[model samples]
Target: MLDIKVLGPGCANCIKLESLVKEVVSEKNLQANIEKITDREKFLDYGIMVTPGLIVNGKVLAMVKIPTKSTLEHWLEKESSI
Candidate 1:
């Protein structure tokens, strides 16, 4: 299963990214472990100084911006196979 994490402090962009990720996962029926990370210390642990970070399979994918659907799908597809 794909292990994904959305790192944020409950900002608007963070919420939007989280929602978008959830939507894509549901629509694709992909097996994934998605988590919402709101702790600032944890973000530092992940080397994320920006809110709305997307982490996939233990690797940070995006920081500070909401990813597009296609970008998300591509990542999901890649990670699901692992």
Candidate 2:
């Protein structure tokens, strides 16, 4: 399963990112464990300095901005291959 993490401080953009991840997962029929990490300390532990970050498995994929559907799907697909 894809271990997906969305790191943020629970802002509107962060919430929207979470929704986008879910939508992409359903659209792609991906089996994933989606996690929302809102704690700043935990977010820092991952070495991410930006909000609304996307971490696929253990690697960070995006930061600050919400990702497009194609990008989300592509990242998840790549991670699923591993």
Candidate 3:
């Protein structure tokens, strides 16, 4: 299964990112482990210097800006195969 982590501090962008990830997972019908990391300290562990970080399978996929649906699907599809 693909492991996805969204790191943020309960901000609007964070919430939207989390929701978008969930939607993509559901739409793609893939089994994934989705986690929301709200603790600021966790960001440091993930080497994230910005809110709304997207980590897929322990690799940082994005930070700050939200990824497009196609971009997200591509990441998810690639990671889920591994």
Which lDDT value does model 2 have at 33? 96
Instruction: Give each model a TM-score.
Output: 0.96, 0.93, 0.97
lDDT of candidate 1 vs native? 0.92
lDDT score of residue 81 within candidate 3: 89
Q: What is the lDDT, from 0 to 100, of the residue 30 in candidate 2?
A: 90
Q: Lowest-scoring 10 consecutive residues by lDDT in candidate 1?
A: 73-82
Highest TM-score, which number?
3
Tens digit per residue, CA lDDT, model 1, 5-68? 9999999999999999999999999988889999999999998998889999889899997889
Would you list the C-alpha lDDT of every candidate in the order shown? Answer: 0.92, 0.90, 0.94
Q: What is candidate 3's CA lDDT for residue 2? A: 88
TM-score of 3: 0.97
Give the alpha carbon lDDT tens digit for every residue of 1-82 in model 3: 9899999999999999999999999999999999999999879999999988999999999999999989999999999988
Q: What is the lDDT of residue 63 in candidate 3?
A: 97
